[model samples]
Target chain A: MSFFIAHTVHDALTALSDGARPVAGGSDLVVGARHGKAPLPPHLVAIDRIAELREVHHTDSGVIIGALVTHHDIEMHALLTTSYAGLADGSALVGSPSTRNVGTLGGNVMNASPAMDTGSPLLVLGAEVELQSLRGTRRLGIAELWTGPGRTCAEPDELCVAVHLPAPAPNSNSAYLRLEYRRAMEIAVVGAAAAVTLAADGSISAVRVALTAVAPTIIEVVGLVGGTVADVAAAAAAAASEQATPISDQRASDRYRRHTVGVMAGRAVQAAARRAGGEMIPVPLNRAVGIGAAS
Target chain B: MAIGWWPSFSVPSGAYVKIDGDGSGQIITGAQECGTGAVMTLRQLAADEVGLRADDFELVYQDTSVAPYDMGATGSQTLFNNGRAVVAAAAQVAEQLRALAAQHLEANAADIVLADGVASVAGTPSASVTIAELAAQAAGGELLIGHGSGAPPAPPTTVGSTCVGDVGMAAWVAPQFSCHAVRVKLDRDTGVTRVLQVSAAHDSGTIINRVGAEGQVQGAVLMGIGQALTEGTTYDDQARQRNPALLEYKLQTCADAPTVDISFIEIATPDAGPRGAKGLAEAPNVATPAAISNALAQLVGHPVRRLPMTAERVWLSMQPAEPEVAG
Candidate 1:
């Protein structure tokens, strides 16, 4: 029943340590409560106003996106859109205009929905989350952070401060895409993200592929290394379909998800390879490639 | 593409128009304005008859205690039925105004023409009297007030037809007709269908308000798209309603609205509403779902036999048909 607004990261961590749940936009928490998925926590600390947590810092090794950096910010940011295009593609398709304006990267990561647009892209891009508390701070790989659907490994007293993403290598890029019924206000029925690095002779040298909403958590495709663009994309698609452990639900059946996620993985790899070959594809591969609705 | 729908019945409508001392007009009616601008369009009908601007009239409606009896805003009958009554009532006032102006101008009432707030002798504009002055004279003596209850038009008779439980639905009164042709882009891999363009042609008689009529068609087309592809009610094993929230019951957003091209047939007929106009609001809603369904059928090679044909259903329909087994 108690609510506190934290102006600093110190204050937010202190409130978290005192058993207060940290809230940024409350897009998930409030909506979930309204849908009777869960009740609101007894105490809440609003961390949206913390200035340091709202910044995006670029270091020598990688980029550090603040916990409060909204989907709107990440999708529109020039560096993120050009260099880390897959994450930008995922962020851009998060929700409608208003949802993107308020929903933050930290909140989406913490909510831990397997179908979250950002998760698969973050996994493919070698991203990690920085969880902080009054005791200390620690970083965990994005894959290790998610345990199950709507379940994360972070403790209640630890607030996710930022997400760290390694810089892309030369001649490398990534892309993400999802199967959506509508153009806006939609969750991914199934999705995939792929990162690709091309050698001098225009063959894929290193590649990573990840699938969303086809398992208990965002899962990576296995045994994909170096090959021609067509060979690697085809291999990723087959591996994703086989590795997926999807369950039937209202959005899609397991059979449909298994088939479509593979298609999406293959398309993502092709798009990523095209970007790596110096193609200036737009931020969202969905609209650029005409995946959802015709404008 | 598909064509369908007709207005099934008719209802009585009534209205009263009065000219006050200040030359402004007042209309009192039981017709309701349910965001469709049906009742608001009544002013245009009255203005055409009374030879005044639509803004010169003040409307008092949706008050049963004071206004005359109307069937309310249902069945797209507000403008169709109430417009006739409003024109009838305003015509009565027009007749009285011409008679009053003829007396002052020393001319016959038949020769007097009411236009632009002035009553003039047909070809002689100089010999005219202002309607405001005529209203002032009438306010001192005979008041200018008129009322009309337009009788409901009879339903058309149906021949060579037998009905089991006919609730008078076999016949139609001033039936509306429409055809919708839709162009869609569908992703075969994901089974997602997106309507790109819709060209709709409606024979809803004469259109009174072009903007309002086009808006109704566009809005209804969007609704039909939702019904064809996304909106559906799900029920659990106990017959309890599931997916009751907006999150599950998907409605079309503005982003999903297609480019709609609208055209009206503009047919004029006898024994119908004012200027032969028919009921319209619900007619455009009839053909869009069928149009979308037909378009999807062309893409998938077979009909998607379900309402709100979700991507999953469309994908299932596209799977190769299993070979029939010998009994």
Candidate 2:
């Protein structure tokens, strides 16, 4: 019923305290409302014009990505594509070119869809969501922020300001892969993301794996540690399949998702290990590994 | 790959060709232009008979009050039927031009040749007069207008078969044939099939418009791929359609298009449409789904046996059979 355009983070946080929902790109909110999934919120504040929230700043610890940074920017940024290639892979495959241009990482993180392309990659990278309000600011682990499907733990008066990612270990890289029927404008039937750190002997010193579209929220695979690349990849596959609690829907059956997520986890680990060993696999491992179509 | 589709017969089309005093022409017909360029090809047919460039003519079509009656664009018969009528009408104008030229050149009417905007005696290029000048002379007395409705060809006879409830579709006039060979890569883990390359061969008689015909084949093959893998309607137990919207019913996009190689088997038949050309629009659409289905079957060791072999269906087909338990 009412709309406000915020010029600064303080303005956006003040509007949020006044029962206004913050909208950066509105790719999910507008599209879902148009499809009769839900009605638009009565009071809305547009925060896309805030310049401070649209930056990707490098910190001594890692990197700080503003909430309004779009998928197009993240996918094309030199630092993100080189050091944080897995996140780039997820961002590049978000939607069609037009959707990627308008859809932001902040909106994706706040919407908290279990099937979101960026969720698994951010989880595997040990990212944290920074929520700000008129009172103060607080940072929560990415896993803790997502409570359930389409539900987040952040209060109504809080706005997601930035996402903080810790620097990866030396000789470490990440990769994300999804089971998609088409190359563009698709949702992942099942997907996996892996972050692998290689030891001096070309073995996996540490690794983390996460699954998408197989549970209420993006869930990470546990009990994976130092081992050969093959052993870690196999273990990640088994753990992902055992941990995922996917449901049956029109996109895919639960059985199919359970099986394919395992396959995707193994492939993601292998791709991450290859990237860690100085092999230049492309940004999206899907096309490079011949998953979707032949280019 | 598969081959199919027969051209519909006994559909009549009529046209009128009028030549102005300035040698420019107009073709009036009721054929519809539906992005296939079938109606546009009529100008080429008229130009071949009138001895002018295809661009020299203006077309007035798809209006019943001004143009002649046409069977409309359906069953891929717009080109097959309207093309013959256009050629017949243009031939009448050509005959009139030759007669007029014979009078000026003092030659036989049969020996008059029309070429390059001029009418001349068959063996003497020097004995020639421009068609525009002849049209100017004719405009003083006689108006140049020709109308024709070419009779539809009879349907092909059947040899040993007698139908019980024949609705006149049991026999075809000029049957079109095609084969589409598609190479697809399937991910066994996810049951996703991606078409890599397509080689489509069609036998639709002489290809009148090469580029337009090739485009039809390419577009149809993409549609076929959607039908094979993604397009389908789901129904619930109460006979209600579940996925009625496009968001649920998936259609392939340009990103999903494969590299298509098209070839035409040009067979000029004596008893078909104009210049032995048959219907081509719908012929290319018949074999694509089958070609993709066959490729998937070869990979899965058995047919999925569904309209659109979705990833779930293909995965279900590949599952091992359950063991029998002792009672």
Candidate 3:
């Protein structure tokens, strides 16, 4: 018989019920088991049947994207592309186009990987996640999403139910970049994403920069580039350089990654400035092949 | 077992180049066709000597029962070592045809020119006969077959290292050199490696088949990349490779590699054979990991010398910096 856990979610404290896991698409879980990265879970509670937990609804307050929202959904949803460009871009960059259709935002937040592509951009965009368990439900800011490598602030028995992102202003824009080894499909060596807003006079009013694959957790520079546009790149680079600590490995050195972060941050800031108020810069790869694009 | 021939010589079936009437040739050898185009190159050399095209041969190889004794398929010796054998056999056959044609045409064997499978007088056009026709007359009463054999000089006992293992071994010495360069991506957080681009420059001696030689270089590079970044066998506290399932044991994915640009330089080697060219197969693979390691050293500003640059190692490297306590 298949090792499985069956339950109906009727206001269930999702996290406590899951006891460290919530199963929707089990890509990550199954991969971890097949690789012996994590022990095989004999019991898995499938939360996908819960309609309320998988719905996307927009209201005047803000957009509440269900945790089950796939990267494919984020890339295609009109409201997400317009209001939450950073989150959409982050989701779209998770893996391949096929992975975008099956991998979920909740899984990413719960996975708690320091090199998580989506985590860094979502954090920089001021996103929040809701963790539900048997006791009740609580919302935590994306900044507090992770504690360390593969470890999050969510209690062992909590399930991340939804991702909350602030609606973008008319002058707000964002850009995401992953520095992978190859142009096709591969994991990031290091990546960086930026979100910015310009004042009425077109000077830098606010900026946010985040780096991935560079630390034990997604490193974000909260207050960045509140000055002249000419110096914003330098200021943002300095902030990221101060906060990031990379390690040398076979592929690259800590010094190279740090150097790359500065280069990437400058590039993203320039890109974000040009992209203000645009629908979204079509997740670089899958602009034409949307919703079920062949990878 | 004596053939009653002079000097106790028997019919030397020393690796005959069998040219079936259909013109398809068989190159019997013991080495696998994995990367070494020895079989094809050998066939081509035999075909050239036998007055035929290189592709008109099928190589039956990697079986000890049939192939002539080879000095193993390493050190780029496939061509100069074994190819000479087939060349000698084909040359002897060509000579036999010249002698036969000379007798039939009432001419000196030395004056007979063999071209397009026909023997004729120099500067004479009409007075020519095909070898097949000449062979037909011989086949009615007799047929001729020739033989050839050669092997590279074995290493002297003074060179090879002493064998500590059960199997007998030979000492090694460097006779060739190659250079390579690689660009890679290192994960900033987890130290994962990804190959971006590879460039190689080698002097293997003679370009027998351009595609075949490049394929060998590319295959060697692929194996080198895997050894450098992926395909590591992990051992536990008891010193065992804990991973048995192929899934956990990582292999280099096609997507994980960058396009490789290879260049082959032919250095005329005086003693290698007909034209100077030493084997470049194993040499190209040797310099790969070293080049990549040097590049990583430059990237990280430190020398991290190990088999694989795993993410765990990189993560551990990113530790709290202990200040110099007034040293």
Give the top-scoring candidate (lDDT).
1
Give one digit per residue, the lDDT tens place, for model 2 in B109-162: 899988888999988999999988888877886776788789888765655555
Stretches off by above 4 angstroms in model 1 are: A292-295, B16-30, B56-69, B93-146, B160-170, B322-327
List, residue by residue over B93-181, the lDDT tens digit for candidate 3.
Answer: 66776787888887887777776666786777477877667666655544545567754434334434555321222212113456787
Give the TM-score (vs. native) of candidate 3. Answer: 0.59
lDDT of each: 0.87, 0.86, 0.64
What residue pairs are clashing in model 1? none
Q: What is the interface RMSD of each candidate, in Å?
A: 1.6, 1.6, 10.0
Ranking by DockQ: 1, 2, 3
Ranking by TM-score: 1, 2, 3
| Fnat (0 to 1) per candidate | 0.57, 0.46, 0.07
- Candidate order by decreasing lDDT: 1, 2, 3
**lDDT tens digits, residues A140-159, model 3?**
89878788888888877777
In candidate 3, position B147 carries an lDDT of: 63
- Encode model 1's per-residue lDDT on A1-295: one tens digit a residue: 9999999999988898999998899899998888788999999999999989989998888899999999999999989998899999999998898999999999999999999999999999999999999889999999999999999999999999999999899999999999888878989989999999999999999999999999999999999988999999999989989999999766777888998999999999999999999999997898888774652
Native interface contact recovery, model 2: 0.46
| Worst window of 10 by summed lDDT in candidate 2 chain B | B162-171
Q: Name the better of 1 and 2 by TM-score.
A: 1
Q: Residues B1-327, candidate 1: write the lDDT tens digits.
A: 999776736777789999999998988998877866764578888877877888888788545978988888777778777888898899999999999989999999999998888889998999999989999999998988989877777656655565722445423667788999999888887788889999999988888888888888888888899999999888777977677777778889888888999999987765667887777777777899999999999988888888888877777788887331110
